[model samples]
Target: MAPPLMTVIGAGDIAAEIDRHRPELTEVVRAAYLVHDAGDSSNPHSSFLRFPHRDRSRIISLPAYLGGEFEVAGNKWIASFPDNTRRGLPRASATLILNDCATGYPFACLESSIVSATRTAASAVLGAQTLLGTRRARRVGIVGTGLIARHVWRFLRELGWEIGGFRLFDLDPAAADRFGAAIGSAAGAADAEIVVADRVEDAFTDCDLVLLTTVAGEPHVHDPCLLAHHPVVLHLSLRDLAPELILAAQNFTDDVDHAVRERTSLHLTEQRTGNRDFIDGTLGDLLRGRRRRDPGRPAVFSPFGLGVLDLAVGQWVHDRVVAAGRGHRESGFFTGAED
Candidate 1:
């Protein structure tokens, strides 16, 4: 057989390439969730590696095999360092490796921060759309102004959400201010009023939608009644809200098993309750018409951010870039291979 093609895609190339392929990214993430919920995907719960000497820093590995329109396996190696931002660098960075299913040969190394952010943004938008139940989002709140938050807002706008106002709250007031300016300058956010809240509750109060993307190791938002009306909490930052809040909300997660890990907010809620009883069906169930949120209560969607999503998006990028002749190609990536 001829040597397998291996592609090395950089972050800049990945970003430019995905600009025209975002719709597919959204669809792939949506499909990954459905396939996963349908028991067609292998999503081993992500493994976290913490540094003994480092505070608020760790790396995560998410491995998955998606079975649907996508039938391949891969893993994402991603790291996060809150201190990186203070040093004027990105907080999170990643690389995605896509492998051939038949031969298990690694075929591509794609810059994955963009892919990770895009997949995550897709999940958040999908969850928000599902929870919205056909209503246009008039107001949205976000805690933590970071790359993930920026990507979520971008995807929301691209997905055609008519957000009238935005509230932002972050531990660093400067981050919030910088993000507020960026959000205001987004393609269609010119007319929307963006507020940088002095308190977390100020951001949470009276919002039709909310996203938590903080980098805290433990829960901070202690008040259960804060989300009393329960605007759909896109619990992007796994461990932010207290368990009592998760208990009172109509909880939905990509995978109940995975979400209840690493001492996430959902995990804490399950431990306190001693069961997964509070979880409403997942996004797949809602897509399958098997689940619905109780209108009387607020909704919380915690996606474990499946690895299959990265694989799907990465695989798509590889195929598209190869066809476009855009990324670097190496035919001898494996010296052990013989033609």
Candidate 2:
């Protein structure tokens, strides 16, 4: 009998393939969300590995199994180091492993930094469209100019969103300027105005859509007045808004239990408010017409990065790479393991 084949997918290959299938990838994420909501998935609470000395550095393990169309199980091992950006590197790096459910053998190892960012960005954009009820925004605000932010913007543009202007805010003005320059040079945003906001609150002002992608380990955004325009906020970072702001908004998350842990902004809000009533419902509920967004307040969507999403996207990438005769396969990866 032959051993299970294991293929390794690199970042470049993953990026090219993902670029070719942006719209399909978004649908894949949306389907994963629906599968998870229908109780066809097992997504355990993510485990955090924090360093005692380096308080801001941590690695996370997300283990999950999706049972519907994608009958696969996997885990994403990801590291987040805020200081890495200071050394001119990305703040997050990740790898994904896919396991065959029947045999429980790992068949693929993927460079998943791009996978992580892509899934996160796709989920964010999906949440935005679900909550906003429209794809055209006269003005948009982005609160972090990092790699994840870049990917979210790319997804928004590539998915045929009509965004008029973008206001960017970053702790480092240079980073904001660089992101602005990149946006200016992108294919679809040629006519859009790019402005670097002087303050974080400025990112939320007068914009119909807002993306919060900061690396803040705690709440830094406290002003609810900044959200007076009732923007649809994609809180991808999860820990940026204060309890006051969360309480004041119409909240939606990928999962209630998942988002209400890990001391995220929702967790902090629960701690302060002494209940979970602040949460409106999951994005799935909204999509399924079980819940409706209140147009009276700012709608904030916080997704606690689900592992099933990683598996779904990773499996898609793996299958495509294999079909196209790309990626490196190790034939003897599982040879004579009983020895």
What are the models' TM-scores? 0.96, 0.98
* Tens digits of per-residue lDDT for model 1, 1-339: 655788899998888877756556788788888877788889897999999999689999998898878888989999998889878999898999888888888888988999999989888888888887853677899999888998887787777778889999998899899999988887888999899999998888889799999888899988878878768899998898898888879999888788888899988887898898888878889888899877778999988888988987888788888888888998877868555
lDDT on C-alpha atoms for all candidate structures: 0.86, 0.93
Measured by TM-score, how close is model 2 to the native structure?
Answer: 0.98
Q: Residue 46 CA error for candidate 1 (Å)?
A: 1.6
In candidate 2, how many Å is residue 328 off? 0.9
Residue-level lDDT of model 2, residues 57-79, one tens digit each, is 99999999998999999999999
* Model 1: worst 10 consecutive residues (lDDT sum): 17-26
| Reference-based TM-score, model 1 | 0.96
Q: Poorest 10 consecutive residues of model 2 by lDDT?
A: 223-232
